[model samples]
Target: MNTTPISSRLHIAIFGRRNAGKSSLINALTNQEVALVSDVAGTTTDPVSKAMEILPIGPVVIIDTAGLDDTGELGELRVKKTYEVLNRTDLAILVIDGTIGLSEFEENVLKIIRDKNIPVIGVINKKDLSQYSEEDKRKWEEKLKLELIEVSALKKHGIETLKMMLIKKAPYDDRELSIVGDLIKPGDFVVLVIPIDKAAPKGRLILPQQQTIRDILDNDAMAIVTKEHELKETLQNLGKKPSLVITDSQAFLKVSADTPKDIPLTSFSILFARYKGDLEELVRGVKAIKKLKPGDKVLIAEGCTHHRQSDDIGKVKIPRWIRQIVGGDIQFDWSSGITFPDNLEEYSLIVHCGACMLNRREMMYRISYAKSKNIPIVNYGVLIAYVQGLMPRAIEMFPLAKMIYEEE
Candidate 1:
């Protein structure tokens, strides 16, 4: 249960107007005081998430966000943050204030949710306080053209029915898009080339590495972990030819050199490029590198925030490499963590992190947004492989991606 990463879990976000029983719905759903309850207009200023197992639905992350109707300068900021939650939200629960009925705000929120193609559950909260009857409920259902579950969160009424609805609407097939599982067979050995550098976390493997190893095991494949330097030795020591070799983007040069061409080779970032985003599109973005001029802007986006290391891959290494390849004072911009810049049209290209910390929805949103803006976007792995002149060999395992690279 604890093994599931939050990023991988089903993200169910509750959104509504201030004092709309959003917090109350969260608490009742979890059967605990997971979210703060108050008479105040805005108790949850930021998105707060709790990970737990809802049977039949399995492991999930429930997010409670600030009300969309929050006002004032600070409240507007809070509301903006709440909207950002939609980027990562897998499923949404739009809580309607039973007394107030559906307002323009709720209708607009519904529009945005529909626009994203996210499956949602409409919940009419504070049901006990409302004088509305069955006919009114039918009216809401007719108005929205979707089922609405009425729940008196304060009274803990209809919570079970809501949970069942969540189970029915939940997306359980995302795990089918494995990190490294699909490439290897049950008994095949897969080698991982991880480099423990200054940027490496002190005590444990990073999220991408950990998730990859777990995916291999889950698929009943053997995962052989080794440092980038020991990749040659590890491959030699294997009794049989391993199915695939996955390395960190930083070590693509050395690892690609060590791994035989006969064996399929790729990187964690590349895997995530496919797992979390569009692989073929990203592969196409690599060609944009050749067109970059000195004065052109490149946006480096990271999904997680951390202390910058002397040779941090996102901050230092990527920028330095881009300068070396593209040359001559390219205006490099950086954005890290939750908020992705809306002004993508300002950049010629976007170099994104592996995005292991982010869920698929958010990463896809960024990729699609960049595409919509007519800006080329590529991830750490694909860009590194491209720059190193080893992209063909690195992506040979995936025919479609390789074809895209070849065509570009």
Candidate 2:
């Protein structure tokens, strides 16, 4: 891929009331006409996301959302969509109309952002057009309990200051998580067992595999790629035993058998279980497979939407396997991309995809939501390995989760 994937980029969503210059601020932030701008209110009917590089922040996706104060039935729908954007937003800029100032709508949205624990910057846009006394500005800030920066998007004023603040507030500077980098050091060999099946994307490896290889290379490790059937021979022919053997979940059984016990074994999706969300929690969720009855409902969620193939892993293969293992008429529901189902109480278990198409924030939100609802949530790789009785081996690379799984 020539550009960074949307899932890997930081998600910065802009929120404000109608005529708050939210679109104009986005254009100023990007230094381009990223969103349609006009004097008209509610020009942005839907969330428009632009992926670009912002120097210190690197690759980031900035989203412009519809006004939360929109009225009528259609406006309500648009507002609902804007609310959904919070699930994926890493950073939020609550744009305030300089003339109107902060109202009940802004206050509510601010409360929601704080409850979600997302980093936010309050900005009063249209600074050039609206004039407020210093006392009035202080009063508004006091009411909102947030410091507001005065910015004129049309004048390109205070835009540099905002960018600097974004870099400082960026979460990754404090978080240390990696796909496969932490498992091995430089010059170590890592074998990737890829299956060349009908489901494999044409002319390229899938997202997880591609990202895994990139991470390995980024860590200065050597990556050896092979198919499932050749895994045995590939391991035998290697000059040195690899530090780890990473395989697709579909080839778990065969890859496990071929890989020596000395070498750690895991799958792309399993690594993602840690990289994207909570690995220990997913490990715990795998145990719920034994509790699933024939009539239990399982929600299979994906981070991206796509046309389903006849032998699609999420739609067909996963459901078929779960049925064979559970041995009953289990109900399966599917939710994909942007919005997760709010009817979470109806489901017994949630089987999420690897979340390659979602940022860490959204993935964590889904997992936490499932926890709040008291439902077990496991990802595709973890569930598959657990059902196949290879979960311990699958998670051997991660010590804490593996210990927890084995102990319990």
Best by lDDT: 2
Whole-model lDDT values for every prediction: 0.89, 0.90
TM-score of each: 0.97, 0.96
Candidate 2: Cα lDDT at 82: 94
Runs off by more than 4 Å, candidate 1: none
Which 10-residue window in model 2 sums to the lowest lDDT?
A: 168-177
- Over 205-236, each residue of candidate 1 has an lDDT whose tens digit, in order, gives 99999989989999999999999888888888
Candidate 1 lDDT: 0.89
> Residue 238 deviation, candidate 1, in Å?
1.6
lDDT string, candidate 2, 288-357, tens digits: 8878998999999999998788889899988998899898889999999888999999999999999999
- The local lDDT score (0 to 100) that residue 22 gets in candidate 2 is 91
